[model samples]
Target: MTAKAKYQEVLDLGASLNIQNGDVKEENGTLKVWGTANTPYEKNLIWDKIKAIGGESPSDIMADIKVADNSVYHRHTVKSGETLGKIAIQYYGKASKYQDIFKANSDILKNPDVIHPDQELIIPNA
Candidate 1:
């Protein structure tokens, strides 16, 4: 397959993420991609998709994904029936890390267990 075709999913994912300053080029069988992700978490998701498609060190594709925000790992919008512990597991793989999330969002979160839907919380880096 052509390099561009091989990495079509990566391009699609970048579009879905609304990556800024995105550029793509295919030269001499190498697919080159560049973009800025809003957060480290978003950048990681792009990298994970690339790796999943190209293997650990696939030489056919090259990507330069930059993170726009370094202050926090990600800004998470709370969903119904979701707890900080569950969100922590999704990002840090540990439920106990919920305390860290709670603390980071302490200005808005008066109680760790009293979170409601539609609240935006800062998910501190692990």
Candidate 2:
């Protein structure tokens, strides 16, 4: 199959994610995809789709996926028993940085001690 055809699923996945500045081209029998994802999780989703279709570490597709928000380290999907301090420690290595996380997600978070499961929080730059 042509490179573009081989990786059509990956391209479709990118579209579903609303990738910005997306470009798809076939070069030397390899599918080349370039785009900016809103978050690291979204970028990983694209890679997961590519690997699902092509196997682990597929050599047939070359994807350049950039995270749009470089200022933030990554996004955190809150789980049960997860607090801003706990999440902060996971990304910032210091539980004391919980205030930063609270400030970053102030739109949804009213208190640093209270966070609900499944809430997506932005882990801002330290």
lDDT by residue (8-94, candidate 2, tens digit) is 888888999899999988878888889999877678788889889899988888989999977776788999998888887787679
lDDT of 2 at 73: 68
In candidate 1, clashing pairs total 0
The digit string of per-residue lDDT tens for model 1 on 13-67 reads 9999899999999999999999999999999989999999999999999899999
Tell me, by lDDT, which candidate is best: 1
In order, the Cα lDDT scores of the candidates are 0.94, 0.86
Where does candidate 1 stray beyond 4 Å? Answer: none
- Each candidate structure's TM-score, on Cα atoms with residue i matched to residue i, is 0.96, 0.60
Task: Estimate the TM-score for candidate 2.
Answer: 0.60
Query: Positional deviation of 63 in candidate 1, in angstroms?
Result: 0.6
Model 2 lowest lDDT segment of ten? 39-48
lDDT of 2 at 100: 90
Clashes of each: 0, 0
What clash pairs does model 2 have?
A: none
